[model samples]
Target chain A: MITVRCFATVREILGCETRTLPPSSTPQLASDILRIVAGARTTDLPKPLLVAINCEHASLTSPVKDGDEIAFFPPVSGG
Target chain B: MIIRLQTADFDPEREAQALDVKGAGARVSFVGTVRDTAQDRRIEALEIEHYPEMTRAELARIGTAAQTTHDLLEVLIIHRYGRLQSHERIVLVTVWSAHRAGAFAGCQAIVDALKTRAPFWKKEISPEGAVWVPGQTPQDLR
Candidate 1:
């Protein structure tokens, strides 16, 4: 299973912090899971989300594998 | 170079004194504090979230980038997370180099990089309610 993590606004929007999705025979990209979250949130894919695969910056086109931790959130606001 | 991510508030003076000061012609230190207000609303505190491994990775990357881009002698970074009150220091960045220009430029780069690259989310707490700080790109920060 691939674990998905959401933070900040995305977590609040979905009312969930984590969701484990069953790995599919076909390769799953980060955007695919993001689509699911947006659907669950009852929103039309709000704004662009910043993605990280296993804690590293990744794009929507990045691939996902079983046991991988994918996090989605808004752009950073830190210093 | 040094990097520290902690929830405990740090003493900037103590940290500054701990660094090697000899052989450096210039030093620049920056401390970021939580403002009491944002968007005309009073902010009582901020709750911060971060990805542990990711925070370390990105901070290291920013440190290295600042060093190479600005040619610095030393670099230091400290960031705090968790519930924190207004006026509390949120981060500390220090840069040392043979010249003031490099120190200034390197420190700026390090700060800017941290704001955008670091995987940290903050929420603003006030009388109204706790609200997530709106996110923006690095360019928009300025």
Candidate 2:
């Protein structure tokens, strides 16, 4: 299984902190999980969101393995 | 070499005193504070979030890169997390060098690299609404 984590606005929108997907799931990149979560959302997901795999910022095409942990975060407004 | 991820506010005087030591002729410091307004919109507060491990690693990498690119003596970076109000200091970057030019260049380069590469995130809360700062992409790297 792969663990998917959401943060910031995405977490608020999804209302779930973490979810697990089957290892055989298709579209296994960090961005793919976003598309999946966004698809399930009632509202449109915000643009310019960021994705990370195993605590490292990752591109949309970055591959994910079984048991990988992924996180999504929106742009930072901090100083 | 000091790195801190803290929730408590920091004092510039304390940081300067701690980083200042023998062999350093110049010291450059940059403090980023939460502004009361952004683009004319009044901000009430800011909620900062970060991928913990990633943020630390990224900041350290930036510090190391700065040291390599410039002649420097020391570097210290401290950032606060959690809720922060307007006009409060959010981040502090300190660099010490033998010359003013090195100190200035090194400090600027470290901050710039952190902005572009660090995984820390921020969300502004205002009376009007909340907005996230746009994420920096690879193209933003200098």
Candidate 3:
């Protein structure tokens, strides 16, 4: 299973924090996972999400294997 | 020299004093606080969220990059996550160098880098509602 973590507005829009993807799609790319969930509320997700795999920043094209943890959030605004 | 992310507030003066450089003559420090207003709304608080390990990694990268650009003796960055009320400090950047030019530039570069590169995102809480700053509103995105 792949665990997808959402934050901030994406959390509010999806109404869920974590999504577990079954092993059938054992090795989906990060962008593909985002596409699947982005359908729930297409417009609500951040235009460009900052993604990370296992606490390390990653691009959407990054590979995701079963049991990997992924996170998505809006771009940083802190100073 | 030091970069940290914490939920608790920090004492800027105490932090500045902590960076002891024997021969470093110039030091510049920057402190950023939550504003009382944003998008013309009276902000009540700021709720910051960040990637745990990634935030640390990015901050360190920015600090190191700033250090490389100048003759810096030391650099410190402290950023806070979680809920913060208006006027509460959010981040601190301190740079120590042999000369004022390097110190000033280093401090500014670090702060600028933090604003864009760090993994932290803030949502402004006001009477209207909470909205992520510098981000498209849910309705707008819809």
Question: Which number leads on TM-score?
Answer: 1
Top-lDDT candidate index: 1
Ranking of all candidate structures by their DockQ, best first: 1, 3, 2
What root-mean-square deviation over C-alphas does model 3 reach?
4.2
**lDDT per residue as tens, model 2, B20-50:** 4678999999999998998889999988887
Q: Please, what are the lDDT tens digits per residue for candidate 3 over residues A1-79?
A: 7888887777787877888877543567888888877775766777776777887667788898887888887766767
- Look at candidate 1 and give me any clashing residue pairs: none
* Interface RMSD values for all candidates: 2.5, 2.8, 4.3
lDDT of 1 by residue, A1-79 (tens): 8888888777877777889998878898988888876675645333667888988888788999888999888888887
- Using TM-score as the yardstick, the better of models 1 and 2 is 1
lDDT tens per residue, model 3, B57-98: 878877898999987899888999999999999999988999
Better of 2 and 3 by lDDT: 3
Task: Flag the better candidate by DockQ, 2 or 3.
Answer: 3
Best-to-worst ranking by TM-score: 1, 3, 2
Best by DockQ: 1
Error of 2 at B51 (Å): 2.2
* Native contacts matched by each model: 0.73, 0.32, 0.55
Which has the better DockQ: candidate 1, or candidate 2? 1
Model 3: docking quality category: medium
lDDT of 1 by residue, B1-142 (tens): 8999999999987897898766799989999999999999999999999877888988998899899999898998999999999999999999999999999999999998888889888999999999888765445322
